[model samples]
Target: MVAEKITQCMKPHGEEGYQTIENMNENHKEISDFAFECVNVGENDKILDIGCGGGVNIEKFLKLTSGNVDGLDYSGVSVNASIRQNQNAVESGRCNVIQADVSDMPIDDESYDLVSAFETIYFWPDIANTFKEVSRIIKPQGQFMIAQGTDGNHPDDELWLSTVEGMSVYTADELEKYLLNAGFKSVKSFKKENDYILIVIAKK
Candidate 1:
Protein backbone atom coordinates (compact mmCIF):
# COMPACT_ATOMS: atom_id res chain seq x y z
CA MET A 1 0.00 0.00 0.00
CA VAL A 2 2.82 2.40 0.82
CA ALA A 3 4.61 1.69 -2.44
CA GLU A 4 1.41 2.09 -4.41
CA LYS A 5 0.79 5.42 -2.74
CA ILE A 6 4.28 6.53 -3.71
CA THR A 7 3.72 5.67 -7.36
CA GLN A 8 0.38 7.43 -7.39
CA CYS A 9 1.97 10.57 -6.02
CA MET A 10 4.78 10.38 -8.54
CA LYS A 11 2.27 10.24 -11.42
CA PRO A 12 -0.21 12.57 -9.69
CA HIS A 13 -3.85 12.17 -10.77
CA GLY A 14 -6.01 14.24 -8.40
CA GLU A 15 -6.10 16.92 -5.73
CA GLU A 16 -3.88 15.10 -3.30
CA GLY A 17 -1.49 14.18 -6.09
CA TYR A 18 -1.30 17.81 -7.15
CA GLN A 19 -0.32 18.77 -3.61
CA THR A 20 2.32 16.07 -3.64
CA ILE A 21 3.86 17.51 -6.83
CA GLU A 22 3.85 21.01 -5.36
CA ASN A 23 5.76 19.73 -2.37
CA MET A 24 8.11 17.75 -4.60
CA ASN A 25 9.00 20.86 -6.59
CA GLU A 26 9.82 22.67 -3.40
CA ASN A 27 12.23 19.99 -2.25
CA HIS A 28 13.70 19.12 -5.64
CA LYS A 29 14.98 22.54 -6.59
CA GLU A 30 18.59 21.44 -6.58
CA ILE A 31 18.03 18.45 -8.80
CA SER A 32 16.04 20.56 -11.22
CA ASP A 33 18.79 23.17 -11.37
CA PHE A 34 21.36 20.49 -12.13
CA ALA A 35 19.22 19.14 -14.94
CA PHE A 36 18.66 22.60 -16.41
CA GLU A 37 22.38 23.17 -16.85
CA CYS A 38 22.69 20.09 -19.08
CA VAL A 39 20.35 21.47 -21.71
CA ASN A 40 21.37 24.15 -24.20
CA VAL A 41 18.35 26.32 -24.79
CA GLY A 42 18.55 29.11 -27.36
CA GLU A 43 17.24 32.61 -26.97
CA ASN A 44 14.44 32.01 -29.48
CA ASP A 45 13.91 28.30 -29.04
CA LYS A 46 10.36 27.16 -28.43
CA ILE A 47 10.50 24.40 -25.83
CA LEU A 48 8.16 21.82 -24.39
CA ASP A 49 8.72 20.35 -20.97
CA ILE A 50 7.31 16.82 -20.75
CA GLY A 51 5.78 15.80 -17.41
CA CYS A 52 6.20 19.33 -16.14
CA GLY A 53 5.00 19.06 -12.54
CA GLY A 54 3.49 22.20 -11.01
CA GLY A 55 5.07 24.24 -13.85
CA VAL A 56 8.23 25.03 -11.93
CA ASN A 57 10.50 24.00 -14.79
CA ILE A 58 8.39 25.93 -17.24
CA GLU A 59 9.02 29.02 -15.17
CA LYS A 60 12.72 28.24 -15.16
CA PHE A 61 12.78 27.72 -18.89
CA LEU A 62 11.16 31.10 -19.38
CA LYS A 63 14.10 32.72 -17.62
CA LEU A 64 16.54 30.67 -19.69
CA THR A 65 15.02 31.49 -23.05
CA SER A 66 13.16 34.49 -24.43
CA GLY A 67 10.96 32.11 -26.47
CA ASN A 68 7.71 30.41 -25.56
CA VAL A 69 7.70 27.49 -23.16
CA ASP A 70 4.97 24.85 -22.99
CA GLY A 71 4.24 22.28 -20.34
CA LEU A 72 2.67 18.84 -20.89
CA ASP A 73 1.56 16.38 -18.22
CA TYR A 74 -0.59 13.27 -18.36
CA SER A 75 -2.35 14.21 -15.13
CA GLY A 76 -5.20 16.69 -15.29
CA VAL A 77 -4.47 17.66 -11.73
CA SER A 78 -0.91 18.40 -12.69
CA VAL A 79 -2.04 20.36 -15.73
CA ASN A 80 -4.24 22.53 -13.53
CA ALA A 81 -1.48 23.06 -11.02
CA SER A 82 0.95 23.95 -13.79
CA ILE A 83 -1.46 26.46 -15.22
CA ARG A 84 -1.97 27.97 -11.80
CA GLN A 85 1.74 28.16 -11.21
CA ASN A 86 2.41 29.69 -14.60
CA GLN A 87 -0.71 31.76 -14.86
CA ASN A 88 1.17 34.95 -15.60
CA ALA A 89 3.14 33.36 -18.41
CA VAL A 90 0.03 31.77 -19.89
CA GLU A 91 -1.79 35.05 -19.76
CA SER A 92 1.11 36.71 -21.55
CA GLY A 93 0.97 34.08 -24.30
CA ARG A 94 4.40 32.86 -23.28
CA CYS A 95 3.41 29.49 -21.82
CA ASN A 96 0.70 26.87 -22.23
CA VAL A 97 -0.06 23.84 -20.07
CA ILE A 98 -1.89 20.84 -21.46
CA GLN A 99 -2.84 17.41 -20.21
CA ALA A 100 -1.01 15.01 -22.45
CA ASP A 101 0.51 11.53 -22.48
CA VAL A 102 4.05 11.19 -23.80
CA SER A 103 3.30 8.11 -25.90
CA ASP A 104 0.44 9.96 -27.63
CA MET A 105 1.08 13.67 -27.50
CA PRO A 106 -1.56 16.10 -28.78
CA ILE A 107 0.90 18.36 -30.54
CA ASP A 108 1.75 19.25 -34.12
CA ASP A 109 4.67 17.59 -35.86
CA GLU A 110 7.99 19.42 -36.17
CA SER A 111 6.78 22.19 -33.91
CA TYR A 112 9.37 22.68 -31.19
CA ASP A 113 13.09 23.29 -31.13
CA LEU A 114 13.63 21.63 -27.76
CA VAL A 115 11.83 18.97 -25.73
CA SER A 116 12.90 18.20 -22.20
CA ALA A 117 12.01 15.26 -19.95
CA PHE A 118 13.15 15.69 -16.39
CA GLU A 119 12.92 12.76 -14.02
CA THR A 120 9.66 11.57 -15.55
CA ILE A 121 10.47 8.81 -18.03
CA TYR A 122 10.25 6.04 -15.42
CA PHE A 123 6.48 6.07 -15.67
CA TRP A 124 6.38 6.37 -19.46
CA PRO A 125 4.25 3.60 -21.04
CA ASP A 126 6.62 2.62 -23.83
CA ILE A 127 10.04 4.26 -23.70
CA ALA A 128 11.05 3.49 -27.28
CA ASN A 129 7.75 4.45 -28.84
CA THR A 130 7.64 7.60 -26.76
CA PHE A 131 11.07 8.54 -28.06
CA LYS A 132 9.69 8.25 -31.57
CA GLU A 133 6.78 10.46 -30.65
CA VAL A 134 9.19 13.02 -29.23
CA SER A 135 11.18 12.88 -32.45
CA ARG A 136 8.07 13.48 -34.53
CA ILE A 137 7.21 16.66 -32.63
CA ILE A 138 10.66 18.21 -32.87
CA LYS A 139 11.92 20.24 -35.83
CA PRO A 140 14.92 19.01 -37.72
CA GLN A 141 18.06 19.42 -35.59
CA GLY A 142 15.89 19.95 -32.51
CA GLN A 143 17.22 18.59 -29.26
CA PHE A 144 15.75 16.26 -26.63
CA MET A 145 17.18 16.38 -23.16
CA ILE A 146 16.38 13.68 -20.60
CA ALA A 147 17.47 14.26 -17.04
CA GLN A 148 17.19 11.67 -14.26
CA GLY A 149 18.57 11.29 -10.76
CA THR A 150 19.58 7.70 -11.40
CA ASP A 151 22.06 6.39 -14.00
CA GLY A 152 20.49 2.89 -13.72
CA ASN A 153 23.68 1.73 -12.03
CA HIS A 154 23.10 3.53 -8.78
CA PRO A 155 23.01 1.25 -5.75
CA ASP A 156 20.16 3.20 -4.18
CA ASP A 157 17.86 2.67 -7.18
CA GLU A 158 17.45 -1.01 -6.32
CA LEU A 159 15.13 0.02 -3.54
CA TRP A 160 13.13 2.31 -5.86
CA LEU A 161 13.02 -0.40 -8.55
CA SER A 162 11.68 -2.95 -6.11
CA THR A 163 9.24 -0.62 -4.42
CA VAL A 164 7.86 1.33 -7.37
CA GLU A 165 5.63 -0.83 -9.52
CA GLY A 166 5.58 -0.03 -13.25
CA MET A 167 8.74 2.08 -12.86
CA SER A 168 11.87 1.36 -14.86
CA VAL A 169 15.29 2.95 -14.43
CA TYR A 170 17.31 3.15 -17.64
CA THR A 171 21.07 3.27 -18.12
CA ALA A 172 22.78 5.78 -20.39
CA ASP A 173 23.61 3.09 -22.94
CA GLU A 174 20.06 1.79 -22.92
CA LEU A 175 18.66 5.27 -23.43
CA GLU A 176 21.17 5.97 -26.18
CA LYS A 177 20.08 2.87 -28.06
CA TYR A 178 16.42 3.81 -27.77
CA LEU A 179 17.08 7.36 -28.99
CA LEU A 180 19.19 6.21 -31.91
CA ASN A 181 16.69 3.53 -32.87
CA ALA A 182 13.93 6.15 -32.68
CA GLY A 183 15.72 8.13 -35.46
CA PHE A 184 17.81 10.63 -33.52
CA LYS A 185 20.87 11.73 -35.43
CA SER A 186 23.21 11.80 -32.42
CA VAL A 187 23.06 11.05 -28.69
CA LYS A 188 25.28 12.21 -25.87
CA SER A 189 25.06 11.55 -22.15
CA PHE A 190 26.51 13.44 -19.19
CA LYS A 191 26.76 12.62 -15.49
CA LYS A 192 27.40 14.66 -12.38
CA GLU A 193 30.63 13.67 -10.72
CA ASN A 194 30.26 11.28 -7.79
CA ASP A 195 26.53 11.37 -8.22
CA TYR A 196 24.00 9.19 -10.02
CA ILE A 197 22.53 12.08 -12.02
CA LEU A 198 22.39 11.35 -15.75
CA ILE A 199 21.43 13.74 -18.54
CA VAL A 200 21.12 12.49 -22.10
CA ILE A 201 20.82 14.86 -25.05
CA ALA A 202 19.74 13.71 -28.49
CA LYS A 203 19.49 15.61 -31.76
CA LYS A 204 16.72 14.95 -34.28
Candidate 2:
Protein backbone atom coordinates (compact mmCIF):
# COMPACT_ATOMS: atom_id res chain seq x y z
CA MET A 1 0.00 0.00 0.00
CA VAL A 2 2.48 2.57 -1.17
CA ALA A 3 5.19 1.47 1.17
CA GLU A 4 3.43 2.49 4.36
CA LYS A 5 6.33 0.49 5.77
CA ILE A 6 8.35 3.68 5.57
CA THR A 7 6.01 5.37 8.00
CA GLN A 8 6.39 2.40 10.25
CA CYS A 9 10.17 2.46 10.13
CA MET A 10 10.14 6.17 10.89
CA LYS A 11 7.32 6.17 13.39
CA PRO A 12 9.71 7.89 15.75
CA HIS A 13 11.84 6.61 18.59
CA GLY A 14 12.24 9.85 20.45
CA GLU A 15 15.26 12.04 19.71
CA GLU A 16 17.65 9.14 19.59
CA GLY A 17 16.45 7.98 16.19
CA TYR A 18 16.48 11.48 14.78
CA GLN A 19 19.81 12.12 16.39
CA THR A 20 21.22 8.96 14.89
CA ILE A 21 20.07 9.86 11.42
CA GLU A 22 21.45 13.36 11.73
CA ASN A 23 24.79 12.13 12.93
CA MET A 24 25.21 9.33 10.45
CA ASN A 25 27.34 9.85 7.35
CA GLU A 26 26.25 6.75 5.54
CA ASN A 27 24.28 8.83 2.99
CA HIS A 28 23.75 12.43 4.09
CA LYS A 29 26.73 14.28 2.73
CA GLU A 30 25.67 14.15 -0.88
CA ILE A 31 22.10 15.08 -0.10
CA SER A 32 23.33 18.00 1.98
CA ASP A 33 25.62 19.24 -0.77
CA PHE A 34 22.80 18.88 -3.27
CA ALA A 35 20.67 21.16 -1.10
CA PHE A 36 23.24 23.90 -1.40
CA GLU A 37 23.46 23.45 -5.14
CA CYS A 38 19.77 23.37 -5.98
CA VAL A 39 18.08 25.98 -3.83
CA ASN A 40 20.95 28.42 -3.59
CA VAL A 41 18.73 30.23 -1.16
CA GLY A 42 18.68 34.02 -0.80
CA GLU A 43 17.51 36.38 1.87
CA ASN A 44 14.15 36.98 0.16
CA ASP A 45 13.23 33.50 -0.93
CA LYS A 46 10.44 31.24 0.33
CA ILE A 47 10.99 27.48 0.28
CA LEU A 48 9.15 24.26 0.89
CA ASP A 49 10.47 20.97 2.29
CA ILE A 50 8.16 18.10 1.40
CA GLY A 51 8.25 14.87 3.38
CA CYS A 52 10.43 16.72 5.83
CA GLY A 53 10.63 13.78 8.25
CA GLY A 54 12.85 14.79 11.17
CA GLY A 55 13.13 18.35 9.86
CA VAL A 56 16.92 18.27 9.61
CA ASN A 57 16.87 19.78 6.12
CA ILE A 58 14.63 22.60 7.27
CA GLU A 59 17.10 23.36 9.98
CA LYS A 60 19.92 23.32 7.46
CA PHE A 61 17.98 25.54 5.04
CA LEU A 62 17.29 28.07 7.78
CA LYS A 63 21.01 28.65 8.06
CA LEU A 64 21.06 29.46 4.35
CA THR A 65 17.98 31.67 4.08
CA SER A 66 16.78 34.83 5.75
CA GLY A 67 13.37 34.04 4.24
CA ASN A 68 10.73 31.55 5.30
CA VAL A 69 10.89 27.76 4.95
CA ASP A 70 7.90 25.48 5.38
CA GLY A 71 8.12 21.72 6.06
CA LEU A 72 5.42 19.14 5.47
CA ASP A 73 5.37 15.40 6.28
CA TYR A 74 2.71 12.76 5.94
CA SER A 75 3.24 11.53 9.45
CA GLY A 76 1.81 13.53 12.32
CA VAL A 77 4.37 12.00 14.64
CA SER A 78 7.12 13.21 12.40
CA VAL A 79 5.66 16.69 12.19
CA ASN A 80 5.45 16.94 15.96
CA ALA A 81 8.99 15.71 16.39
CA SER A 82 10.27 18.09 13.76
CA ILE A 83 8.47 20.97 15.44
CA ARG A 84 9.96 20.02 18.75
CA GLN A 85 13.41 19.84 17.24
CA ASN A 86 13.16 23.06 15.24
CA GLN A 87 11.04 24.96 17.73
CA ASN A 88 13.23 28.02 17.80
CA ALA A 89 13.18 28.30 14.04
CA VAL A 90 9.43 27.79 14.02
CA GLU A 91 8.87 30.27 16.83
CA SER A 92 10.96 32.79 14.98
CA GLY A 93 8.72 32.23 11.94
CA ARG A 94 11.70 31.34 9.80
CA CYS A 95 10.46 27.73 9.48
CA ASN A 96 7.21 25.84 9.79
CA VAL A 97 6.24 22.14 10.09
CA ILE A 98 2.92 20.58 9.12
CA GLN A 99 1.56 17.07 8.73
CA ALA A 100 0.47 16.38 5.16
CA ASP A 101 1.06 13.95 2.32
CA VAL A 102 3.34 14.77 -0.59
CA SER A 103 0.50 14.51 -3.14
CA ASP A 104 -1.79 16.93 -1.35
CA MET A 105 0.09 19.61 0.51
CA PRO A 106 -2.00 22.32 2.14
CA ILE A 107 -0.27 25.06 0.25
CA ASP A 108 -1.16 27.25 -2.72
CA ASP A 109 0.15 27.31 -6.28
CA GLU A 110 3.02 29.58 -7.18
CA SER A 111 3.91 29.95 -3.53
CA TYR A 112 7.57 29.07 -3.29
CA ASP A 113 10.96 29.73 -4.84
CA LEU A 114 12.16 26.20 -4.19
CA VAL A 115 10.77 22.80 -3.24
CA SER A 116 12.80 19.91 -1.84
CA ALA A 117 12.18 16.28 -1.01
CA PHE A 118 14.88 14.44 0.88
CA GLU A 119 15.06 10.64 0.83
CA THR A 120 11.29 10.49 0.88
CA ILE A 121 9.80 10.14 -2.59
CA TYR A 122 10.45 6.41 -2.79
CA PHE A 123 7.64 5.94 -0.35
CA TRP A 124 5.09 7.78 -2.42
CA PRO A 125 2.72 5.44 -4.28
CA ASP A 126 2.17 7.97 -7.02
CA ILE A 127 5.43 9.70 -7.79
CA ALA A 128 3.90 11.66 -10.66
CA ASN A 129 1.07 12.93 -8.52
CA THR A 130 3.61 13.94 -5.93
CA PHE A 131 5.55 15.93 -8.52
CA LYS A 132 2.34 17.49 -9.74
CA GLU A 133 1.68 18.80 -6.25
CA VAL A 134 5.22 20.08 -5.96
CA SER A 135 4.97 21.78 -9.36
CA ARG A 136 1.76 23.53 -8.41
CA ILE A 137 3.32 25.13 -5.37
CA ILE A 138 6.42 26.57 -6.98
CA LYS A 139 6.72 29.92 -8.75
CA PRO A 140 7.78 30.21 -12.36
CA GLN A 141 11.45 29.33 -12.79
CA GLY A 142 11.52 28.01 -9.27
CA GLN A 143 13.64 24.94 -8.59
CA PHE A 144 12.59 21.49 -7.37
CA MET A 145 15.11 19.03 -5.99
CA ILE A 146 14.80 15.39 -4.98
CA ALA A 147 17.44 13.80 -2.76
CA GLN A 148 17.33 10.02 -2.41
CA GLY A 149 19.46 7.36 -0.82
CA THR A 150 21.30 5.27 -3.39
CA ASP A 151 19.93 1.78 -3.42
CA GLY A 152 23.17 0.43 -4.83
CA ASN A 153 25.20 2.04 -2.08
CA HIS A 154 22.70 1.80 0.70
CA PRO A 155 24.81 -1.10 2.16
CA ASP A 156 21.62 -3.01 2.53
CA ASP A 157 19.93 -2.96 -0.85
CA GLU A 158 20.28 -6.68 -0.99
CA LEU A 159 19.06 -7.53 2.47
CA TRP A 160 17.50 -4.59 4.31
CA LEU A 161 16.74 -1.82 1.87
CA SER A 162 13.25 -0.41 2.07
CA THR A 163 11.43 0.61 -1.07
CA VAL A 164 7.95 1.07 -2.52
CA GLU A 165 6.36 -2.37 -2.12
CA GLY A 166 6.47 -3.53 -5.71
CA MET A 167 8.52 -0.91 -7.52
CA SER A 168 12.02 -1.51 -8.76
CA VAL A 169 14.98 0.81 -8.26
CA TYR A 170 14.65 3.92 -10.45
CA THR A 171 17.55 4.79 -12.70
CA ALA A 172 18.61 8.43 -13.01
CA ASP A 173 17.29 8.52 -16.55
CA GLU A 174 13.95 7.11 -15.47
CA LEU A 175 13.57 9.65 -12.70
CA GLU A 176 14.42 12.52 -15.01
CA LYS A 177 11.99 11.28 -17.63
CA TYR A 178 9.13 11.25 -15.15
CA LEU A 179 9.97 14.69 -13.89
CA LEU A 180 10.03 16.05 -17.43
CA ASN A 181 6.74 14.36 -18.14
CA ALA A 182 5.34 16.08 -15.07
CA GLY A 183 6.16 19.40 -16.80
CA PHE A 184 9.42 20.22 -15.08
CA LYS A 185 12.02 21.99 -17.20
CA SER A 186 15.80 22.13 -17.21
CA VAL A 187 16.05 18.76 -15.51
CA LYS A 188 19.50 17.56 -14.52
CA SER A 189 20.79 14.90 -12.15
CA PHE A 190 23.85 14.27 -9.99
CA LYS A 191 24.99 10.96 -8.60
CA LYS A 192 26.67 10.53 -5.25
CA GLU A 193 28.54 7.67 -3.55
CA ASN A 194 29.03 5.54 -6.59
CA ASP A 195 25.49 5.67 -7.76
CA TYR A 196 24.10 4.88 -4.36
CA ILE A 197 22.19 8.14 -4.23
CA LEU A 198 20.91 10.50 -6.91
CA ILE A 199 19.95 14.15 -6.74
CA VAL A 200 17.73 15.57 -9.44
CA ILE A 201 17.36 19.30 -9.98
CA ALA A 202 14.58 20.59 -12.18
CA LYS A 203 12.89 23.91 -12.81
CA LYS A 204 9.21 24.75 -12.97
Best by TM-score: 1
Stretch of 10 with least lDDT, candidate 1: 1-10
Q: What is the C-alpha RMSD of each candidate to the true structure, in Å?
A: 1.7, 4.0
lDDT of every predicted structure (CA atoms) = 0.88, 0.72
TM-score of 1: 0.94
Candidate 2 lDDT, tens digit per residue, 74-165?
Answer: 66667876787789989988888888767777888899998887876666767777777788899999989888766334666544345424
Off by over 4 Å in 2: 1-7, 10-30, 37-39, 151-168, 193-195
Give the Cα error of residue 94 in candidate 2, in Å: 1.9
Off by over 4 Å in 1: 1-5
Query: Which pairs clash inside model 2?
Result: 150-196, 150-197
Instruction: Give the Cα error of residue 185 in candidate 1, in Å.
Output: 0.8
Query: Which lDDT tens digits does candidate 1 get at residues 31-141?
Result: 688887778889999999999988888989999888999999988888888899899999999998988789998899999999998888988988899999999999999
As for candidate 1, its clashing pairs are: none
